[model samples]
Target: MSTATDLAELTARVRAHLALRHPDSPIGDLKTLPGGHSGLTYSVTAGDARYVVKAVPPGQRPVGRNDVLRQARVLGALAGSAVPVPAVVASDDRQPAWFAMDFAAGEAVEPVLDAPEVPAGTARARMLEIASVLRRLHGTDIRTPGLGAPEPLDAAGELARWSRTLHAVPAELRPGGEELLTRLADALPSDGRQPVLLHGDFRLGNVLCAGERAVAVVDWEIWSVGDPRIDLGWFLLFTDHRNFPHLGRAVPGLPTEAELLDTYRDGRPPLPAMDWFRALGRMKMAAIMGHNLRRHREGKHHDPDQERLPPTIAAMIRTARDLLA
Candidate 1:
């Protein structure tokens, strides 16, 4: 990762690389885009061509947080599929991994999901569009050699992973995370699901909507071959008032949990014990918030946005426990 002083040097490197790739077209405007947590995004233009450069953050990144190569591979695999994903242009695996892709031409409408003023019909349409896109993504064949074979379901292993994450959090901030982990493990769903490609962090925030269509589903860092229900569970958790108090309100026209589930399950088998998955999702989020807050408190990372996460963590833990109840 390049230091602040070396940002221009990094840009220059990008310019030089693009120049070689397009010998007839010299690089033009280059600017860093914002709003991502794990990596940096830059809007680059060469002559008449425009693209997005996704790069790892300046410093070391935690596991599963930043995987530029994996993201590029997934995008490449989705080429010609129904899933709306940016086309990969180039990828570099050297230190401070980075890749370039076509700039998705739409606005991310996560914020719009909470706007009470938006018309009910418009809101409902947007929510359904999100579900539709997820359906396409999950429907993608995971057996493709490039995407690799689906990993066998390991409910116990999944529980253990979240448990480790919870234990790593500062006990003072999340005393109940461990207990919730135990309860979740004990009640882990035994009936296995057919493995599908899960957009692990699917939600409004990760989608860019154009009218009633999902232009693209960005942010593929945590994507994997897993139970498709996990994605549904995570999506519902994000919008559930019991979890994200600030952003979970039911907006006008926005599809209810039942509607979203219905849309997702249209042609698939019935989903089971969704509340359990929701509980696990909340637990996972709480642990992640705890970890992020821990990082901020230690002066390891300074992010003002994280200041509000402590309350979120508490809400998440309480929500997870209540779901168990």
Candidate 2:
């Protein structure tokens, strides 16, 4: 829904922000990147140097919602760490908002997710590596300033947030989703004391992979300090399927639930409420898909994959019920 004017204005704003941040770097032409619903992303060239600029919407920007700054801070904090996050060049947290960072050159991993040649073992290894990086990220001491205070939500708090989100979804989309939300809310767990930084959305789509290895982790808007299990749960929903026709060949690179847990825990204290958190994760995805489908139904957005959602939501509901049972 972005007009040429919107792109032009955003390009100008990003250019200005980059100039102020990197005065020496002579910026060249700018091009907008595709595949994002909430925020705007751009790829720019600066005198043979390339960088990416990420920014929220101009006028309707959400309060306390600056994804560019948040991502920059995360990358800055994870510097010298084992996590494979992008390196931030400069961050501008002011108005006409944007942040600049080195644009990763690798091909995005999304197109290959459904490819035939990409072996399951390769996918599994990358998933494990991602899990390890997440574990290390969560284990890091989160006392750094400018990264914002860590807010680790308990099960109840997560339920409330997702529940509110579901309510905000249109009534036409609420049929099967409301019951799933209720199931998660009623079955909320009481444990999970050790809180670490979470990637919020740690799915294959947000990662950039070259062959078998993950070169860089993209999309840090939802990154925050929370239960790490939430990340695992989200991944399972997107990648694991018992009903997909291509389940045997299509599902590669996935770790057993036990293996994923072992990698995440890595000899740390046992996560007693892991199942509860996983179920909550399924419910969360269902709500998100419902909202998107609602938008599509209302003619606000168009997605060819919208028709495939009802079954997916059903699968998530079944998965949540099975976990709770």
Candidate 3:
């Protein structure tokens, strides 16, 4: 078990701790992995074996996404599944709590496919592969060990959670959220589905890839079991640049939304209505942007890019309204 508290000190300390665990081992420098929110992620080595450690900030109680063990549980359950996941080597809940997983080697692809160094054809193939993998994930047996029968989606609660975030934002920033949300709540899809594990934020940005295939879906922090449409619709949004106007469109080689749907729906039953689901995904994303943008403008956080979100948020709500109409 590690006793280090300061995250900055972990580069050497984590390696030292692990080296003791695996004597005559861990010859490389430790790396602080990127993009995690508040959690401390480290790439450490032990005896020619590389593993990633996802930890709650040392000395604090794990709560919500900070609960690294919950992520470990999901990853552990998915280890041998068709969906790619790293293997959990260890986890500890005591102070400086963390879980270790064998490092799954692959490139962490960006959300904008065209930006990757790979050929456009490879990026296009990755999207189709993601669709294929997502379908298999949605079809995985929910009865799998460590995750039992999941609660059917609580549609009202889901809407309410995002509603609170929208309400928290300045009215101008969250333009038309009220109307979009109202229509979304009314058209909410059936809460019932034969539930399966959801990657929650399933998207190209969330996966690591090698040669048009996703080698691992790495973030399990928000994973839950519920209507698979929640995962599907959210992923489909990234294919179109309008959903993220600040990010600009480099969509030429990527699969169209219709084409991706065809890939995901190949063996499943005729697809259910997806318009409402798509609108709900838009509303949820807008709520998140509104809240974060407000925080940015208020100086609580300072991401200059969020200054551009007002129009993006407006467009999302406007489009959602049209979808509902």
Best by TM-score: 3
Q: What does the lDDT read for residue 37 in candidate 2?
A: 52
lDDT of each: 0.76, 0.69, 0.77
Q: Each prediction's TM-score against the native?
A: 0.88, 0.86, 0.90
lDDT of 1 by residue, 7-34 (tens): 7655776787788778899786558787
Model 1 alpha-carbon drift over 4 Å, by segment = 4-9, 57-63, 112-120, 149-153, 246-250
Look at candidate 3 and give me any clashing residue pairs: none
Candidate 2 lDDT over 84-197, as tens digits, reads: 777787666665567777877665443233543446677777777666766767777777655674677766766798878778776555556666776776777766666677
Ranking by TM-score: 3, 1, 2
What is the lDDT, from 0 to 100, of the residue 167 in candidate 1? 90
Segments of candidate 2 deviating more than 4 angstroms = 1-13, 16-26, 62-67, 108-117, 170-176, 243-249
Report the poorest 10 consecutive residues by lDDT, candidate 1.
Answer: 111-120
Query: What is residue 121's positional error in candidate 2, in angstroms?
Result: 2.7
